[model samples]
Target: MARRRDLHPEEQALWQAVASTVTPNIRHRAKTVLPAAQPAISPVDPPPVPPKLPAFRLGEKLPPKSVRPAESPLRMDAKTHARMTRGKLAPEARIDLHGMTLAEAHGELIHFILGAQEQGHRLVLVITGKGKPGREDDHLHRQGGVLRQQVPHWLRLPPLGLAVQQVAEAHLRHGGSGACYVYLRRR
Candidate 1:
């Protein structure tokens, strides 16, 4: 409990002077009931109050935020992309990441994409096999397999992103959500 100290004579005198100058806004002011007596204790400094923040307006738009560098936007020809996704164009080479851990898959993927690009292969298949269901941390997370979720990100990031031109989800015939189609850049 906080103990109220008796006011200093100088402070009391100043307060009286200020109180005398103020007129009550309401002529019929309600009488203030005094608090019950409290036990005395050493005075502690009070914490400072913070200033109020401005309220947000309804439907106000926020300032635009910087965006992350997303994968290169659809640089391949539309017709080729359509044909590839439709499984009409078969991948020249493919790599299955079904059983590999993240590290192994990443290394193999770098090798595969770079090799395909070196060999002048335009499109290649990367089978991630949609992740497992109901399980929390097996391979990773998502509708497809654990590798399925990470393959695209790895392709979009360093080392692989430079070698790859475009990455799209596989068609049902090719493996659907379980896999991706990686289009390699020309060497």
Candidate 2:
């Protein structure tokens, strides 16, 4: 009978660590000739790639928001107001609402009156120009004249009226029939 060959020194060291009757390395090499009973490691598939996205431009502008500009605080008929108040309320401190649209004038006048009272300004001149005189044939134009005609109505309102100590048409120099001096009560 023929005897099996002995393992080399290095192979012997590895073979001692593996206690199996038949070495796995020997089985791996023998696999080329014979079928393997069990495999060591399964093959791994590669990861999939992702799609690319479009890039943004460097100078693109954003959308604008819905916002309005603040209305001007001074909108009075200066000449008319000056004549009416007789310089009682200085030009710098008075609020005139002569040519302003009704809504714009109304809002600003209310704010000014309230603010002046709060700041302890007792004498305020609000010159609302007298309405345009109506021609004999056109009575409709009478109601729509200068702010002077309209301002008294607005001043009569509870908020505005409450702040005033007196309201009277100005003397000719201050504003004549077109302007009025408003005397505000101290807060």
Candidate 3:
């Protein structure tokens, strides 16, 4: 993957300001300092030993992997795609996963999609906020917008995958860069 260009100083400052406003404040307790004391040990006593971690034995069986559906081509007619792009059809349900961790978002997405499919719904909206702007140091790495990047992948995995028929970016009116339209397979 190509590296993203660094944000200008002004842009970085603006992003920082915006990020600071949205993040929740955390309170930390002040540290307490204690006077140092010498350990009392007996000559016959074995040196205090550290705890040992559990060891994995050879040929140890690992947990089974979760089953995921195969990647099938998205099924949608051009007319439907055009209608979705134009924001002509209204979504039956909508889910916003902003401020959620990847695991949280994935679980919520699966539940939402599965529920929508079970309800016989055809179209839905999933909002994953376009992540925070990347810092200069994050150029070569996976930067912000974690949910935006992972949502599609999650939609293609397991139970949710079997239920989704098509996925498309939402129109400007719906959310432009931060949301998408999820068309579910008929029940």
Candidate 4:
């Protein structure tokens, strides 16, 4: 039976002895005071950032994508390469692999790179939109950009690599990290 009334003297003594022998739960430990000598740390400063994007307007027409001098082979000097990465040199050609399965994208990429090389094009853009944002699980059945992860590997392996001189992430206006600059070698 449970007691609602005060414990008997003998019962109280027995309860105290039993309680004293048991260990205290960690979550119920007494709070401790810290010594006052240590200094607090400040938040870290951010690294240097690139220039911000220009403001957008409703229904504004963008200028045509200028084709920079592409008739040359892919032996780019540092300054010219820098110019290309900064979106200063617009891509001579481009392809979007936004919603493709792995097999389709791989085949398309192979054909595109080889054709661009044969056509004597130097710099081409491959826009693989940053796949669905979050990590997907079985329940959601959502997939991230598999193409983005695989394209670079394909470019480095066989027939495609033979024509590729360099592959770099595209500049912000050129789709930022979502796209890549495939600098093709001349045939």
Worst 10 residues of 3 by lDDT: 63-72
- Show model 3 residue runs off by greater than 4 Å: 1-74, 139-144
| Residue 155 local lDDT, model 2 | 74
Ten-residue region with minimum lDDT total, candidate 1: 62-71
With a 3 Å backbone cut-off (N, CA, C), the pairs that clash in candidate 3 are none
Q: Taking the tens digit of each residue's C-alpha lDDT, what string does model 4 give over 1-187?
A: 9955656668766765765576654555554332233223233345578986434457855422322223224565778688987889889999998788888988999988898888999989998877764442321212335666667778878988789887877888998877889888878
Give the winner by lDDT: 1 or 2. Answer: 1
RMSD of 1: 18.7
lDDT scores of the candidates, listed in order: 0.71, 0.59, 0.71, 0.71
- Model 4 TM-score relative to the real fold: 0.56
* TM-score for all models, in order of appearance: 0.58, 0.47, 0.58, 0.56
Residues 1-187 of candidate 1: C-alpha lDDT, one tens digit per residue: 9987766668766766765676654545545432234223223344587985434456865322211112348888999988987889998899888889989998999898888888999989888775567343222332435566567778888888899888877778988767778888888
Off by over 4 Å in 4: 1-75, 136-144
Ranking by TM-score: 3, 1, 4, 2
Q: RMSD for each model, in Å, please?
A: 18.7, 29.0, 21.8, 18.4
